[model samples]
Target: MNSNHLLLEEPIRMASILEPSRPSYFPSMTKIVGTLGPKSRSVEVISRCLMAGMSVARFDFTWGDAEFHQETLENLKLAIKKTKKLCAVMLDTTGPELLVVNKSDQPIPLEADSFVVLTPDQEKEASSNLLPINFSGLAKAVKSGDTIFLGQYLFTGSETTSVWLEVSEVKGDDVVCLIKNSAVLAGTLYTLHVSQVHIDLPTLNDKDKEVISTWGVKNNVDFLSLSHTRSGQDIREAREYLSKLGDLSQTQIFAKIENVEGLVNFDEILQEADGIILARGNLGIDLPPEKVFLFQKAAVYKCNMAGKPAVVTRVVDSMTDNLRPTRAEATDVANAVLDGADAILLGAETMRGLYPVESISIVGKICGESEKVYNQDSYFKKTVKYVGEPMSHMESIASSAVFNFKIT
Candidate 1:
């Protein structure tokens, strides 16, 4: 007998197999989604992105007026026709964005353990930088020790990146907070995370409804990514609005889960959505940094088990400046693919950046390479675990058989 081999002629155990692979071939396996903005609005740039493996163009309704967004949509349609490439359009709504009125001319920069104020008035845009939030009854809702996550653009060019603030005082219409983390914040927006709150905020504001009515349903956009999706009801509300405006089934919803509340209701939320995005920018603030990766994996795995696409956003945020990504960013992209993300988004990385084209080009390469080894049968059997509930007993048996396959 050979020293390194244990010879066995007969098969001893059942080796499970993946279902028939009737895969549709593509230039790349995982899709690349780039935000259409100043850098990528033009036909030339959009065509370039398509050639570089972009499969979706996300129009963020956060900045610019309605006219600007409409123009972006028109330009996108033209670009799609010119390129003759199959691409989907994503209408990313500005859903329930809570912000503190910056009274100061400069953004309120914070240090660890610093004090900040949150007033309840939305109409009073105070210049004091005392941090007056737009959400009504926010002061009464937040108690001492509640986390108010300020989505700071602390990262070089990441839009929805955030830092934590712990509520230290909750007086009438005034909530004082101590900065729990040190962050040089540039943006004034925030997302609230508490064990509970009597929130009066509408899931989609008047502006969001107007946008969805005019652009989303009428334009027949493929994906509508509702930001800050807190529950299944939020998705149902959007669907209702879509139904009123046009054919309800024309658009697919991509729920953006960005907080602990959303995490708690993820299964229900996914039930309503056609797809989902684990938006890590604000999600990082919602959870401790250590836990965000686990949530991302869970969300992606669940989406996979349900046979729905899951996009992992904010993959290479710092690539806005440098052409090359940090080693960690590269690893992050690879992990997203191996963890079964169907797509990854470039928010500020493509929206307005120094190296948008290079960024897309680089990420395409990373995704292509990562997808090649994403879920080989041997690797899946060794490390994969389905957190999602199997639909039936047959599915459970199939899942078990998959993991029980022998190496030999």
Candidate 2:
């Protein structure tokens, strides 16, 4: 080859070695979604996440009470205004599931095949079958043959049960149930439904609603992510609440698909929601563990068919807590990108992990690489149909600019 050709060939060879050899699923431009928790709610942390390419910040409303939520909302608004970053806030709600907490203040170990009792107490306690769970509606939701999870242990239900245990006999404040043979993280158990699971209902509890409503009005948050969404009515309730404060017409709402009934009523929910979030963590509890993957794929396809943006949330990298993500996890994330997710959510990874920055960097790298070889345009067009339609009309002008630049 000529000397000039040899130089070009060298660059190509270097690139091939430095990057994946085969076609990838990365996109030229990808949107990023992040979760905001204790570690990431501050102005500094918020700036870091945004600088790292976070386009959206998911604010989980489940952890604290109304007062706590108000404080967080205010802090978030101040940070956004100070930084002048173009990031969106996503307000998430806890549905009817009984969310449990480890009184031990850390990850608790549960022996395999051990009998444990769970109760409705907030204090974590030691027991075979009794642990404290908080959802008042939990008794109504769980049926027999349902599996409870605490870490990875699975407890088969002898029958549909809500056997109330004596509060005095309960040793600790909480008991972990291994549900459906899935890895039980810090969560509670409950039956999943798509028809809006009403617990506290549409009204914000006490004065907290006023605080959140104020933030909503001031920031004009880009999206509201409703957790534990059961039906289109849930969407309506949330919308109605937001409407009372202000227009909220520009804001979009996302229905979290994390339950059996939610999946069943997915079509109706989509019609009401501006988008949908595939919350696999809780969905695993609602359905058979093995079916989570199928359900996820189905949800994605359904969302795509409906032309709504779908975000894949939860445990995108759960194992990252102890060690680096396994190859399986990497491939799992890449596969989701290929599946045409508008955004992949980083929950614990960014919220409480050691390698938060690395996590986002890895995601960005993987997504960027994957788009090079993947039919990204096809996926984007199919998924973001609304956005794509407008862009298509403007494509000609952009194409002409490119042609002129090429000539010059």
Candidate 3:
């Protein structure tokens, strides 16, 4: 072990060990699904999102009509082609449910202490003071002490589990009464139509069905998000509809588990559905807000064990509406990724945020960091050399030796 000989051999050892492998694999990018909306639907805007690392674009079926969706799909496809990226499209269906108000021309405002009754009546206006929701047994479900929260505020009122209230407030067309303590939620996008009803079949509404068919025919859509899906039957019905429209090949189904029924029948739903989307906006209304975190972890693990992609969404914060996401918002996204979600969806963050591009960029950065932390061990393991199949064969040994460059 002379000093000169040791120094000379150290350089040779370093050169052999540090050489790159012939076929190296890198960690895959976590899919980012950006919702398509008026402000974000133009060619330039869509392109910017994709350039910023969006892998999928979601078009909510609840928003526009078939013709409008057709136009959006056309524009999205053109953008994908122009950018040379294989971005997928998702068409989210609105079940046979009803939101309190029609699409607003401007953002709706909800004041503190307001009483709103939700009934089956769509004509029920703000003055009705009665927020008529379309689900049965709704008024009966409201217990004496339940805190119902709308967009970001809580509503307070009486004993019947079916009805909720907080008397005192100015109301325009704001999305009303985010009810708490219900098995199934009412009033948000994908709110349950037959929450307490005895409906037996998949409740695909006419308007939503038409949009699903159009998006299916367009063939650009990559996923069909079944909202308010309560069972395996719902997934089956949606699949049949997609098949009818000739979209069975590549387009997949993602069942949104936002209710008690969906949570209970998860195994059945997963069998029929391609993936699961944890829609917490309405889901939190059904379960305890604290429980949502536990449930989210369980859902992520369940989907992972089943080898299905799961997406956690509704990371609503002041930033989603204002300029930046709160710390809680950041933690929510990071936890989902660490729990093994294949994707993280951006809703209002992209739909109506002041900085939609910035929102998505921040989301990407979080996702990138989470992936790095979660996959670090796997990254190193993949670098270790291993023999391939048919290890006993001489030729295979020679191939490995040559490929590894272990022998000159």
For candidate 1, what is the TM-score?
A: 0.80
Candidate 2 residues lying further than 4 Å off, grouped into runs, are 1-28, 65-85, 101-114, 121-129, 150-211, 318-323, 376-408
lDDT of 2 by residue, 124-193 (tens): 4623344445544444434433444333211112122222221122234333333322123333332323
Q: Estimate the overall C-alpha local distance difference test score of candidate 3.
A: 0.63
TM-score of each: 0.80, 0.70, 0.71
Instruction: Please give, for residues 247-319, the per-residue lDDT of candidate 1 as tens digits.
Output: 5467888899877888999999999988999888777765788999999888887887777899998888788
What lDDT is reached at residue 209 by model 2? Answer: 52
Worst 10 residues of 3 by lDDT: 152-161
| Best candidate, TM-score | 1
All candidates' lDDT scores? 0.74, 0.60, 0.63
Q: Per-residue error at 98 for model 2, in Å?
A: 0.9
Model 3 over residues 36-117: C-alpha lDDT tens digits? 7776777888777777777888887665667776777678788898877678878887774444443222333333344345
lDDT, model 2, position 80: 69
How many residue pairs clash in model 3?
20
